[model samples]
Target chain A: SQQGEEDPQALSIQEGENATMNCSYKTSINNLQWYRQNSGRGLVHLILIRSNEREKHSGRLRVTLDTSKKSSSLLITASRAADTASYFCATAGGGGSNYKLTFGKGTLLTVNP
Target chain B: IAGITQAPTSQILAAGRRMTLRCTQDMRHNAMYWYRQDLGLGLRLIHYSNTAGTTGKGEVPDGYSVSRANTDDFPLTLASAVPSQTSVYFCASTAAGPNTGELFFGEGSRLTVL
Candidate 1:
């Protein structure tokens, strides 16, 4: 079973529009991180929000974590074609020496010019 | 920084053959990980090492094996390749600390099993 799941398997939008993706996890986590992957490439870290933090921002990227709802959302403001990629949400489970991250299926965002 | 690098950007192997995917990081991070990405399945952890010389199983470790002989290299091996094992493999590393958990990933290795 997958620990995290993202909604809207695929999304398409025009440039300058805001793109939002949501992720839901099954268990408590110490932190949640968002990553972006271009076609045929490995993932790149975008932002991370700890369990205690409600929201975070980096450049045009914004992330929100709601532990109560076991969900998080990533928002890209004024999206560009370069932002077209797969967005994944990973959760770092609480406790244990694992420190392993569980990832969601991901949201494929396609930004068109 | 060069970051992480994976060998053999792409490969095609027969089903009963053995193959090893190499991953090396230059950042000297304390933690390393191997993950497989399949279409629609996203990325699943295959193995992880908190530090050099120690390894642990992850969500999907059934057909894969990993070894961390040193801090810079972590390689994943498949004893008998299967069609289901064909996917893109990624290697990632992170620093050692509570506040240091962001992973830096390699370009990824794409494997095709015939």
Candidate 2:
């Protein structure tokens, strides 16, 4: 079963615009992470936010985690054509030695030049 | 040059044939994983290894088997391929601890079972 589900299957925007993607999960998590994947390529980690953290930023990327709602969001500011890729949200569940990570379906973002 | 690598970028095999997907990591990470990505199902974990000499089943382990012989290699084997098993397979790894749960992935291997 999928623990996380991203909203907005697809999103299209022009350059210089901001892109926001949301993800919701079913169970409690220790941390939430966001990743980016280009066509026919491997996935790259973008950022991560722990359950105790509400928000974190890395360059133009910002990630927010709302443990109360079991949801998280990724914000990409000043999007560019290079930012066109599929974004995925992953939730890390379990504790001690049984830690596991579950990923969502993902949201496809297109930044048109 | 310092990340996970997978063999057979893509392959097509007839049903009932046996196939193995190879995954090797150069980072010397202790944890490795195998996942299958379908059209609408996202990426489902097939198997994982916390460290060398230990393996665990994930959400979807049917039709797939994995082995972790050493810290650098984790291979997934399909006893008998089925059309339903057609999907892109990915290999990933993390450091000694999975506290942050950040993964580095290989390009992926597209497999088609006819």
Candidate 3:
């Protein structure tokens, strides 16, 4: 079963604009992570926000997690053409390292240059 | 480069045939996983190994098997290929264990079973 569900199945924006995607999971999670995949390529780890962390940042990416709501949001500031890809949110089942995670359907983000 | 490597970048197999997907990581990660990506199913975990000699089943592991004979290698084998088994297989590894969540993924192996 899928643990997380991403909002806005698809989104399109100008290169300089900001793009936001939301994710909601059904069960508790150890951490929520976001990954990006270019066409016909493997996913690359983007950022991870633990249950204890409310928000985190890396470069132009920002992530916020709410354990109570079982939801997380990813914000891409100043999007670029290179940012065009599918973004996925995966949840690590709460409380252990070896525990498996479930992946969401993912949101396709297209940043037009 | 220190990263995961997968073999047979893509393959087309016949039904009832057996196939193995090879994965190797130089990062010395303790956790390795095999996941299949379908059009609407997202990425479903097939199997995983916490460390060398320990293998566990993920959400989807019916016709697949995995072995962790060493720290750097984890291979996923399909006992019998089926049409439904056609999908892109991904091999991932994480050194953070349960504490952190960052998976390093290989390019991927696309398998088409006819």
Q: Of the candidates numbered 1 and 3, which has the greater DockQ value?
A: 3
> What TM-scores do the predictions have?
0.97, 0.98, 0.97
- Across residues A1-113, which tens digit of lDDT does each residue of candidate 1 receive? 57889988999999999999999999989889999999988899999899999999999999999999999999999999999999999988733445778899999999999
Ranking by TM-score: 2, 3, 1
Give the worst 10-residue stretch by lDDT in candidate 3 chain A: A93-102
Most lDDT-accurate candidate: 3
- TM-score, candidate 3, is 0.97
Among residues 3 or more apart in sequence or in different chains, the pairs in candidate 2 whose N, CA or C atoms overlap within 3 Å are none
- TM-scores of the candidates, chain A only: 0.96, 0.97, 0.96
**lDDT of candidate 2 at residue A59, scale 0 to 100:** 100
Error of 2 at A81 (Å): 0.5
Per-residue CA lDDT of candidate 3, range B1-114, in tens?
759999989999999999999999999888899999999779999999888999988999999999999999999999999999999999999876555758999999999999
- lDDT pick, better of 1 and 3: 3
> In terms of TM-score, which candidate is strongest?
2
Off by over 4 Å in 2: B96-98
